[model samples]
Target: MIFTRKRQPLNKLTIAHAAYTLQKEVKWLGITLNPTLSPNLHLRMVKTKTNNTIKQLTQIIQPTFGLCQREARILIVGVMMTKILHGSIIWYTNKNRNTVRKKLTGRLFQAVQLSTGMMKQPPLPCLELYGGIRDITKQNIRLAHNYLHTKLAALIDDGHRTLIWKDLTVPQPIHPSPLNNLIEKNTLLQQHFTRTETLSPFPVPPWCHRGSWKENKSGLALRNLELTWRAPKG
Candidate 1:
């Protein structure tokens, strides 16, 4: 409750900034946001026999644009990387936050050629990870950002290349013009599909949604108030 309320405003602004950054970086890339959400689903299963938690999810095999199913696996990783990068960069710099506010309010919302949608199902993998969000509107931005930053960073790094929108909506790119390439060379861009633990400094500019972790819980639940007395031994 406390964290959500405190983060409400920041989250919105952060998304706004990211939208702007994406525009500047991807303007010539010819990727359109899917307005109709194909809706990705992620499920978590606990193996009773093994007494271990296993995560089950679909691949984020989005090809430039289109629709696909995927797991919420990327969210935790992006947030983790963001939490670390935001702290180091934002704090280290002595700049104004006014730009970040401007980008979120002005650019992200103001855009063209985008396909957008949210998950139709509930009890999502993210619910357990996020302690359960009530609606997609509140959390989808972060989810998408996590997906884009970690997953789509390739598009940003590849620079001046045209990618086939192999996903769903548009065939071939709307813009074949060369892109300026907003990123520097890094190994993660090559390995996003295979490696999971790869980390990099988030590329959000001076003004963007950047935050520190209030708390990041590592293990699963501890006490079950009602079942405290009869709980199985660890």
Candidate 2:
């Protein structure tokens, strides 16, 4: 069975004298996978789920029984945001995000405004800054970073070392590519391996530095270290 964007008829698969046809999309473990492996359907599902949660939160937070702004902020951070972003990093892609970015951002803006007790939705940036909430893009990146960090840590662990090495192995080039050879010939690629830049002897001090008796006790003070010019003896 085959799935395609075109309307062409597809051949049927027969098993035990029974015929089965291809599907345009398949749902597995709550994620929709299409033939192209495109994330459009996944993004749509995420948007739908997020919008539903936002709607529910809005209804539950009516003035009469609504939480105060502070409590609402906590709820937004702890619950609503979590629900909206669940499994986001796994299927997130720039193309899918570009397709639904505005709608998703608008929904997020509305959710934040409602939760924070704002009279009206502010500009997205203002909502992010003044409302003390990260924009959707940053939040998505953060989730991806944290998830990758944890997965990498596990992969590098002794029990999974082999798995890590296996996964990290690069696939062999099936067919030689003229473009790849051309790219490898570039001077920049050679320069990358030849560049030699030694680390500076004295870099910027740590954020909190314990000082000597002559220096300030508070670690907040920036250390003033200087090197005087000297001429070599002839």
Candidate 3:
């Protein structure tokens, strides 16, 4: 697909004796892209797919039988939300816009309502709180920031890092690019840090032998206890 801001006629081309035509939109890597790069169509498609999945889930997540509330919540959040927010880092922006926010939150809340067996009378925030789900906008922003953090941390060349930092930090009027918005939203970007440089508790060399499970039972028990304590209480 040709990406351009102006409306124009499609151009026909022949390459390797094969005819090709310009497409208004195309799917690449499971993301739908148009010439204008607007995310509306892609998001619509995601919403449709999520709706279908929710319908299927409703069959098994009955109020009287099938998956329990906890399992339903897990499925909705872990599977349904993960699918809905797939590729969000690329197309998600203007998250606070009323139209976009309402549409996405409405669809997500439907899934939450299904999982929690809640009535529509409840407010979105209450549904989210009871369902143990984060706001879709917040989740998208966090994902974008985490992606930026990972990319920045993985850069090996100082010059390349500087170039990227400059690009991300560039000022844009009115509507800012997603990366720039992420940089602005996250204070973590103010400092540069590398994952490789971070200190680890287990600093022993790879060649060093570790103790057997029998010898590490106390540590294992402590770790398990910590995890159990940290887990959400139903």
TM-score for each of the candidates? 0.17, 0.25, 0.24
lDDT of 2 by residue, 36-137 (tens): 544566557666776666666565544423234344334444332433243352245445444344443344344333432332422244335655544664
lDDT of each: 0.23, 0.34, 0.34
TM-score, predicted candidate 3 vs. hidden true structure: 0.24
Off by over 4 Å in 3: 1-67, 78-97, 121-234
User: Tens-digit lDDT track for model 1 on 96-183?
Assistant: 4454233222211111001112222221454467655456533543443343334223432322111111123224323211111111
Which of candidates 1 and 3 is the stronger one according to TM-score? 3
Which candidate has the top score in TM-score? 2
Question: What TM-score does candidate 1 get on C-alpha atoms?
Answer: 0.17
The clash number for model 2 is 0
Candidate 3, residue 67: lDDT: 33
Error of 1 at 26 (Å): 35
